[model samples]
Target chain A: MIELLLILCIVAAIIAIESKNLLSSIISLGGVGFSLAIIMLFLSAPDVAFVQILVEVVMLIILIRATINRDVTEVKCKREFFGMIFGMALVTVLLGILLMGIQTLPEFGTALVNASAESVPAKYYIENGLAQTGSANIVTGVLLDYRAYDTLGEATVLFTAIIGAIAILRKKKTNE
Target chain B: MNILPLFVTIPLAGAFVVSLFDFIKDEKKKNISTNIFASLAGLVLLVISIKVIGSAGVYSMGKWKLPEGIVLVLDPFSGPILLITNLISFICILFSFDYMSGYNGREKYYSLFFLMVAGMNGLVLTGDIFNLYVFLEIASVASYALVGFGTMREEIEATFKYMVLSSVATAFMLLGVAFIYGFTFNLNMVSVAKALGSMEAPVGVYVALGLFIIGFSIKSALIPFHAWLPDAHPSAPAPISAMLSSVVIKTVGMYSLIRICYVVFGMNTGQVPEVLRVLGILSMMLGVLLALGQWDFKRLLAYHSVSQMGYIALGFGLGTPLGVIGGIYHLLNHSVFKSLLFLNSGAVYYRTGTRDLKEMGGLGKKMPVTGATSMIASMSIAGIPPFNGFWSKLIIIMACIKSSHPWLAFWAVLGSILTLASFLKVQRYGFLGKVKDSLRNVKEAPFMMQVSMITLALLCLAMGGLMLPGLYDLIFVPAAGIILDQAQYLKLVLGN
Candidate 1:
C-alpha cells in the first residue's frame, strides 16, 4: 500500500516538475519531498521525518524568496519540460527496481545488530553513551564520541564553502 | 585537548576578524594586514596538520568519552586529506594576495577563504552523521555565497541554482541521517554501521542510500546534477576557481560519497557500486562532450574537472584493488593538475582581463612562467608521459582491462584524448597565438602567484615518482589499504 503511495508521489513530482510556472514547479517539488518524508515516517524513522520537514520548509522559504522578483513563467520550453519528465521517470524506475532488490536482502540492518551485540565496543555505546559523551541524545553521543573526526571534516567543508563563497562574490571597488 | 578542533575554530575566528576589518577607512592597509595575517595563519595550519598526522588518535571534544561525547578520529586517512586541505589553502591565500587586488574588500575575502578551509577540515574530521550535515551546510552555504560573490547576472543565477539544489540535497541527506538514527536508535557511524549491518535490511536503508547518493552527487556536481558547476566555477575568481575545482567538490562531494559507501553502508550493498559506475560513465562522457564547445578558457577547465572526476569515480566503481588504487591516485593527481590548470587560467585572466578564448592571442611570448606551466598542466591532464596523470590513467585503464571491461578502458582513453584536444584549444587560442597588441604590455602575474603555479607545475612533473617503491608506501599504500581493508574498518570501529 505504501509503495503505491510512493509511486503516486513520484509521478506527481514528475508532473509538477513539468509545470510551466516556476512557482508551481517549486510547489510540486515540495509535494514530492513531503511524500518522501511520509514514506520515511512509515518506515519507523520519526527523526528523519522531522528533519525532512524542516528541510522542506527551509527550501520553500529560500526558493520563494529567491524567485519572488523574477517572472514565474520566464522561459519554460516544451522540450525542456519533456526532458525533465523523461529524466524523472528514469530515476523513478531505477529507484523502484533498486528498492525492490533491497527488500530481498536478508541481513540488512540485522548484521549491525548481531555484530554490535557481540562486539565489546558496541556494548560500550549500548551502556554508557550518555555517561561518556555527557549528552542524553545517543545520536549526539555517537556523533561526538566515536566518529568525531568525520564530524570535523564535515564542519571544515562548511567553513571552506563559506569562505569560497565570499571570495568568489565579493564586490569590487570603483577606482577605474 | 587535542588540537583538531582548532583547525575549525581558527578559521571561523579568522572570518570574523576579517569581516570586522572590512569597515576600516583605509582599505589598502587593511588589505595588506589581512593578507599577511591569512598567509601566516595558513602556514601555521600547514605545520599543525603535519603534526596531527604524525600523532593520530580519537579526540573526544572537551575531554568527552567515546559514545557519550563528540569524537574526532585523526588517523592516516584523515591525515593526507587534512594535509592537502591546508597546503592548497595556503597556496590559494598566497595566490590571492595579488589576484584579489582586482576585487574589493580584501579582508573579508581572506577571512571567508579561511573559514571555508576550516569547514572542510572539520568535515573531514567529524565522526557523527548529524554533525556531518551541519558541516556540510557550513561548507555548502559558504560556497553558495562565494558562487554569487561576483554579483553579476550569471554568477547570481548560478549561485541561486546551486544554492537551491544543494540545500534540497542537504535536506535529503539530513532526512536520511534522521531516519538512520531513529531506526537504528544510534548516531555514531561505527554504531550506525554496526546497527545497519546487523538489522534485516529495511526499505528505509535504501532510501537513505538514495538520499546520500543524490546529495553527494549534487555536491560533486556529477553530470545529471551538474548544471550549477560550469556556470559557478568560472564565475568565481581564478584562485577560487582552482580551489573549488581542485578541493571543494572532491572533499565535500566525492569524499563524502566514498566514506558513506565504504564505511557507513559498506561496499556489500550490491547495487550501490553499479549506480556509481553508471553515474561515473555519464559524467565522463557528458562533461567532456559539453566542454568541447566552450570558448571560455575557465569554463572549459571547469567542465574538464567534472570529466576527470568521472575517471576517478569510474575506477572506484570497478571495485577492484587496482581500480581503487587508481581511483584514489587519480583523485590526488587530478586535484593537483586541475588546480594548476585553473591557476594558469587565473594568470591569463590577471594579464588579459578576459576568460574568452577568442579574445586571447599569443600570450606565450609575454607570460613565460604562466605559458610554460599551463603547457605542463595540459600535458599532465592529457596523460602525457612522465606526468602523474599518465600513470594513474594508465592504471585505471589497465584495471578496466584486467576486470574484462575493455569497453570502459576504451572510453577512458577516448576521454583522455578528448581532454587533450580541448586543452590544446585553450593553448592555441588563449596562449600560443599571435600576441594581441592590446595585451602587449601585460606582464606576468605577481611573484607569489608565479611561485604557487610553479610549485604545482613542478609537482605535476614529480608526481610520477610517487609510484616508486619508497614513495608509494608512505602515501598511496596506506590510503589504498583503507579501501582494501573494508572489513578491518568495520572491526576497528565496531569491535574490540
Candidate 2:
C-alpha cells in the first residue's frame, strides 16, 4: 500500500516537472502533495497529514492565482538542452548523496543507534511524556513541551518570512 | 537570572512594535517616533550587554535540564561578541537616523533591522544545534529583505542572488543538523558532543562537520563561495551594509563555524583546522586580489570584508593559543574599521549621489569629517601601526609564524600588502585627489552621521588599547581559552 502511494507521488512529481502549461504543472504538484498526505495517513501520522492537506490547499490557491491570468502555455526560455543536462546532473548528484546517506541509516524500523549503547532518549520520551507534559499525544508533547524552544524559533522564522515579503513587495516611491 | 531570552526577545518585540508605527498618518511624527524608539531599544540592548560582559553561566529555558530542553550559554568567549553585537547594532540604528530616510517604508526598515538583531543575538546565545539553525534562518531571511529594501533593480537582483545562495547554505546547515541528530538523538550541542566523543564517531559525523563548515564558509563569504557579497553589501542602504559586513557575517558565519569545529566536534574531528587554513589562505589572497580592480567604493570595501574574514579564519586555523587570540582580536578590530569605512562610503554617496570611485575627488576639503574617518579606517584596515588593525594583523602574522606555517605567514603578509594597496586606491581616488567639478558643491554628512563615523573611528583607535595586558587579559585571552578548551566549555554548559 505504501509502495503504491509512493509510486503515485513519483508519477505526479514527474508530471509536474514535465508540464509545459504553468497551471497543469501546479495542479500536478498538488497531486504529489495530496498523495503524500494520504501516505502520511497510512503511516499513522494523522496530524502531519492533516496539516499537509491544509497547506497543500492554501498553496494551490496561491499558485493557481499566480498562474491563472498569465500566459500559462507559452514557453518563456529556450534552454531545453541546457536544462535537460543540468537536471540530469542534479539527479546524479542527488542519487550519490542518497546512497551515502542510506549507508549511515539503520535498517527499516530499528533505532538508528549504536548497537553497544545502553540507552536512547526515545525510551524516556515514551514513558514519561504523558505525565510530564500532560499531553496524551507524544508528538505534541515533544514539540510543545520538551522542545518548545524550537517551535518558537520556527514561528519566528515564519514571522521573519512574512516581514521579508512585505518589505520586498511594499509600494515604492514613483520616482523610480 | 535567566536573562538570556531577553537578548532575543527585546529586539523581536521592538520589531513588532516598530512595525505598528507604519499606520501613523503624520509623516514627520511617525519618522521621529520610530527612529527614536528603535535607537532607544538598541541603546537598552547595548547597556544590558555592557552590564553582562564577562559574565558566564547557562540558563535553561523553563528550568528544564540539558539534553531535555533548550539552553542559553554565555561564557568568557561569547561575552565580547555579545557586547560587540549590541554595540554595533546600536550604532547602526543611530547612523540610520538619516541614512535610511531616503527609502520608503522606513518603518519596515527599522523593523527588519530589529529582526536581524534578534536573530543574531539568538544565534550567538543558543546552545541547541537545531535552535541555532532556526535562528540562522531568521537572520538570513531578514538580511535578504534588508539587502533588497530599496526596491531598485540592482537591489532586487542582488537580493534574489543573495537569497538563492543563502538558501543553499541553509539547506546544507539543516542537513548537517539532521545528520547529527540521527547520530546522537540529541539536539543540545553539549549532549551531541558528549555522545559523539564516546561513540568513536563514524564517517557520517565527519560528513556532518564538513557540511557545517561549507555552509558557514558560504555565509562568511570565503573566496570560492563569495559571489553574492560584493553585490549585496553595496546595494544595501549604508547602515544595513555596516550591520551586515560587521556583525551579521561574524556572528552567524565565523562564530558558528568556530563553535562547531572547536567546542562540539573537538580536534579529533580531523582536518577541520586544516580545511579552515586552506580556505582562509584562499579567501585572503583571492579576496584582496579581487578587490584591487573594483571602481565602486562600497563594492571594494565589501570585497575587503571577504579578505579580512580570511585573516580571522587564518588566525583560528592555526589551533594555537596565540592564534585564537589573534583571531578574536582581528574579529573585534575588523568590525570597528569595516563599519566605519562603509559609513564613510555612505556619506560620500549621501552627498554626491554616486558610488563610482572615479566620480569622487578631494572633497576631503568639503567633508573633512568623513574624509578623516575614512582615512583612519583605511589606515586601520591597511594595518598601519598604532591602529587596532595593525596590532591584530601583527598578532595574526606572528601566530602564523609561531605555528611554524611560515609559508602561511608569507601569504598573510602578502594579503596585507595587497590590502594596503587596495585601500590606497580608495583613498587616493575617492578622497585625496583634486576636487572634481561635479562634486565641488557636495557637503559633509549630517550631524548624526558624523557622530556615528567619529564614534566608530574613535573605536578603531581605542581598540588598539585592547592589546594592553589589562584589556587583553580581561577579554581576548579568556575568550580564546574557552574556544581552545573544549572540555571546559562542555563542563561550563553541562555542569559536569
Candidate 3:
C-alpha cells in the first residue's frame, strides 16, 4: 500500500513538472517533495524525512518567486507536450523495470545488522565519539577525525564557486 | 590563534566589513573600505593556507574530540587546494580592484565574494556530510545572487536559470545525504563509509549514490547538465569568467563529486568510472563541436571549459594510476591557462569594448603584453609542446592508449585539435588580423591586470616541469594516492 502511494506521488510530480503555468508546476514539485518526505517517514527514516522537508520548502519558495517573475509565454506547441509524454512514459517503464529487479536483492538489513552488531568500531564510536573527538557531536567526529581531508577539499570547491560567481557577476553601469 | 577556525572566521569578518562599508554614506569611502578589506583578507587567506600546508594535521573545531562537534580536516590533499583557492582568490580580488571600478554596489559585491569564500573554506574543511550541505548552500545562494548582480536583462535571466538548475542539484544532494544519514544513522562521511564497509549494500545506498552522481554531475556541469555554463559564465565579468571556467566548476562540481563518489561511497561498484568515461567522451566531442561555430570569444572559451573538463573526467574515469595522475595534472593546467585566457579576454574588453573576435585586429602591437600572454595561453590550451596543456593532454591520451582504450585517446586528441582550430580563429580575428580603425588607440589593461596575466602565463610554462619525478611526488601523487586507497579512508575514521 505504501509503495502504491509513492508511485502515485511520483506520477503527480511528473504532472506538476509538466504543468503549463509556472506557479502550478512549482507547487506540484513541492507537493511531490512533501509526499516523498512522508513516504520516507513511513519507512521509519525520520532523518531523511526531515531533510526532505527542509529541501522541499527551500526549493518551493525559491522556484515560485523566480517563476512568477519569469518571462513565461504560452506553451503554444503540441510537439512539446508530445515530447513530455514520451519522456514520462520512458521514465515510468525504466522505473518499473528497476522495481522488478529489486526482488533479486539480498536481505541487506539482516546482514548489516548482524555484521555491525558484532565488534565493529562504529558501535563504539557512535556512542562515544564525543568523548573521543572532544567535540559534542558524533557527526563532527566522523567528518573531522576519519575523513577531514575530503571535507577540506569539498570546502575549497565551494570557495572556488563563490569566486567564480563573483567574477562572473561583476556589473558595469552607464549614465542614461 | 588556532588556524582552522581562522579560515572561516577571517572571511566571515571580511564579509562583515564589506557590509559595514555598504552602510556608509560616501561612495568613495565605501569603495576604498571594501577594496582594503577584500585585498587584506585575501592576502591573509593566502598566508594562512601556506601555513596550514606547512603544518599538516586535522584540527577539530572548538577543541571537539573526534566525531564530536564540528571538525576541520587538513591534509596533503587539501594543502594544494588551499593554496589554489587563496592564490586565485587574491588574483581575482586584485583584478576586481580595477575591473569593478565601473560597477555599482562595490561593498555588496565584496561582501558576497568574501562570504562565498568563507562558505567554501568551511565546506572543504568540514568532515560531516550535513555541514557540507549547509556550506554548499551558503556558496550556492551567494553565487545565485552574484550571477544576478548586474540586474541587466541577460545577467538576470542567466541568474534565474542557473539558480533553478543549481537548486534542483542541491535538492538531489540533500536528498542523497538524507538517505545516507538514515541508512547509517550518521552524517559523517567516514562513519558512513565505515558502516557501509562491513555491510551488504542496501537498495537505499544505491539510491543515495545515484542521487549524488546526478547532483554533483549537474553542479560540475557535466555534458548533459551543461546548459548553464555558457550563459552563466559569460554573463558575469571577465575575472569571474576566469573563476567560473577555471575553478568554480572543478571545485564545486568536480571536487564534491570526487569526494562523495570515491571517498564517501567507496567507488561506484567499478561501474562509476565507466559512466564517467562515456560522459567525458560525449562532453569532449559535443562541447568543442558546439564551440566551433561560435563567434563570441568568451562564449567560445566557455564551451571549451566543458570540453577541457571532459579531459579531466576521462583521465580520472580511466581508474588507473597513470590516468588519475593525468587527470589531476590536466586539472591544474586547465585552471591556470583557462583563467589566464579569461583575464586576457577581459583585458581585450577593457580596451576595445567588444568580445567578438571578428571586430578585433592587430592591436597586438599596441597591447604587446596582453597579446603575448594570450598567445602563450592559447598555445598551452591547444596542446603545443613545452607548455603545460601539452604534457597533461599527452598523459591522458597515453593513459587511455595504455589502458587499451585507444578510442578515448583518439577522441581526446580530436578534441584538442578542434580546440586549437577554434582558438586560432580567436587569434586571427581578435589579435592577429588588420587593426580595426576604431580600436587603433586602445591601451593595455591596468598594471595589476597585466601582472596577474604575466604571472599566470609564466606558471603555464613552469607547470610542465611538474611531471618531473620529485615534483610529481610533491603534489599530484599524494592527491592521487588519496583517491586510490578506499580502505585507508575507512581505517582513518574507524581507527579514530
Best of the candidates, DockQ:
2
Clashes of each: 76, 0, 28
Local distance difference test, candidate 3: 0.78
All candidates: CA RMSD (Å): 5.6, 2.2, 5.3
Model 2 spans > 4 angstroms off: A1-4, A80-94, A112-120, A174-176
Q: Can you rank all candidates by DockQ, best first?
A: 2, 1, 3
Candidates' DockQ values? 0.22, 0.53, 0.13
Candidate 2 chain B has its poorest 10 consecutive residues by lDDT at B264-273
lDDT of each: 0.78, 0.88, 0.78
lDDT for each residue of candidate 3 in B178-202, tens digit (9 for 90 to 100): 6776566666667677777778877
Error of 1 at B222 (Å): 2.0
Ten-residue region with minimum lDDT total, candidate 3 chain B: B61-70
Interface RMSD of 2: 2.2
iRMS, candidate 3, in Å: value is 7.6
Which prediction has the highest TM-score against the true structure?
2
Better of 1 and 2 by lDDT: 2
Worst 10 residues of 1 chain B by lDDT: B487-496
